[model samples]
Target: MISYSKIRTIAAEKKLMDIVIEKDYVLDWILWGISENDYLKYNLVFKGGTALHKMYFSDWRFSEDLDFTCIKPINVDKLREALILICKDVNNKSGMKIELKSIEASGDTKEDWSYEIKVEYLGPRQQSGGNLPTIILHITYYEPILYEPVKRTILKSYEDIPGDFFILTYPLEEIFAEKLRTVLYQRCYPKDVYDLWRLTKEVGD
Candidate 1:
C-alpha cells in the first residue's frame, strides 16, 4: 500500500484536497481494473460525472462516484465476482488496498436494473465513519445511449502509476445532452448547470 504521506504529498502538489486525490487515485485504478476485466470491459459504459472529468474536462470538479450504464444484463453474482477481482488487481498494481464492502442490486418493475457498490480505501483524513475512505459505484442498466460510446484515452499526472488508460464512454456532446436532460428534470442542481457551462466552453456554441 502507498504510504498516506505519499498520498498527502501528491495532494499538496496538485493543490487538491487530500481526500480528493485519495479518491481519484482509488478511482484511477478502479477504471484501469475495469478496462482489464473482460466482462466489465464490455458490460459497463462509463458515464455520469466521473466520466465527464476523466474522459472530457480536466478542470471539472472531482467526482465521488463511479457511474456506468450497463449495455448488457449481468447477474449480480458475476458482477460481484468481477469487481472483487478488479479490486485485487488494483491493489497489486497501485499498492492501494480497496475492499468491496457491499454490492446491492435493485430494479424497477420494468427491469431497469441497477447496482450500488460501496468500497473502502485507506485514507489519512478518515472522513468516513470508520476512519477509512469510501467510493460509491452506481451501475444502471436502463439508460439508453444516445450516441455510440467511443473508446477515449484517460490520464493522470501521478508519477507512481504511469501510462495512458482507455475507457468506453459517451462522447462529450452526449454528456452535455444528458446534463441538459437532468437540468430540466431538476430545478436546483448547481453542479449540473456548472457542468453544462463547462461543456459548452469545451464543445463550442
Candidate 2:
C-alpha cells in the first residue's frame, strides 16, 4: 500500500492536491488492487466511469464504483467466490475492511448475464454513519463487443492518486458512443452530459 504522504506529495507535484481528496486516493488504490487481481484471476475488463477516468488523462472525476464486462461465459457461483476472495485479499493487503454483502445474477443469455455485487467497506476514511459505504460492482458477462479493447497505462500525472496500472478497456470512441446512448435512451445524469461534452472536446466523433 502506498503511504498517504506519498500520494499527497505526488498530488502536490501534479498540482492536483487541492482537487483530489484523501479518501478518494485510498479508494483508488483499493480499486486498483481489486482490478489488478480481477484481471489476473478472472480476465475481467474494466469499463464505465472508472475506465473513462483512466483513458482520459485530464478527466479528474472520481468514480464511486467499479464496472466491468466479462469477455466470455463463466460459472456465476465460482465468480462470486472469486470476488469475495478478492475483497478479502484486498482488505488484508491494504488494511481496509471490505465484505461482500451479496451477489445477484440475472439475465438468461450469456450475452446479458449481469452480476451485481454489493460490498460493504468499514474503513476510517469514510464518515461515521448509520451504514458504511457500499462498493457496488456491476458486471455483465459476454456483452457484445462494440469495439476492441486495448491496454491503457494510467500515468501518475493523470489522476495524482495511487494505483496506476494497465487495464484492458473499450476504446474512447466506444465509451463516447455509450455515453451518447445513455443520454438518449437511458436515464439522464448530469455527469453523463459533462462527460459527453469533455469527450467531444478531447476526441471528435
Candidate 3:
C-alpha cells in the first residue's frame, strides 16, 4: 500500500509536476480513444526509466521519456489512425498541437509475444536540463504468441486528475526491470545507475 502523500512529496521535492502532467494528458488521449472504441479488453501499462520505482518506497530524483505497453494485439495501422484522429480532435479543442511520430511494430520470438503500435508526440517538445528531449508519448502492444493476450492492469505512481486518467500507469516493478536492461545494454548514464540502485533497494525488500 503506497501512500499518496509520500508520492506527492517526492514529486514536489523533485519538481516533477510538469512532466507528470504532460504524461497524463498524452496517456488520457490514448485511453479515451480505446475506451470510445470499446477496446477495454486490452490492458495498458506505463513502463521505462521515467517511472521511478525507488520513489515507491522513498524519495528520489529521476527522469524518463514516456513508454507504454498494450497487452492486446491490435491493428497497427488502425491504432495509428485512431491516435492521429484523437490528437487532432484534442488539439482542436485544447489548442494543443499533438503530432504523432512514425509507428514501429516488432515481435519477441523468445518470449512468444508480439507487439504493434508505437505512438510518439512531435509537438511541444520539452528539454531536460540541457540535452534530453522530453518525449511526450509512446504506445506499444504486448501479446503472447502462443496464448490469447492477457489483460493486466498496473497502476502508475502518480496523481489522477480529472480528464487525465491515462496518467495512471503500470507498476514500478516493470519500469525497474526495463531500466535495468537499458543500463546493461547501453552506455549507462549516472542517473540511470542511481535510479536503478535506488529502485533495487526499494523493491528488494
Cα lDDT, all candidates: 0.81, 0.67, 0.49
Which candidate has the highest lDDT of all?
1
Report the Cα lDDT for candidate 3. Answer: 0.49
C-alpha TM-scores of all predictions:
0.89, 0.76, 0.52
Candidate 2 lands at a TM-score of 0.76
Q: Mark the regions of model 1 whose C-alpha exceeds 4 Å error after superposition.
A: 1-3, 123-129
Worst 10 residues of 2 by lDDT: 155-164
Residue pairs of candidate 2 with colliding backbone atoms: none
**Candidate 3, run of 10 with poorest lDDT:** 143-152
Q: Write the per-residue lDDT of candidate 3 for residues 39-79, one digit (tens) a residue.
A: 43245454555544311332445433445566655566766
Residue 179 local lDDT, model 1 = 88
User: After aligning candidate 2 to the native by TM-score, how far in Å is the CA of 193 from where it should be?
Assistant: 1.7
Compute the lDDT of residue 14 as modeled in candidate 2: 62
lDDT of 2 by residue, 23-62 (tens): 4544464556655565333466677776777555635576
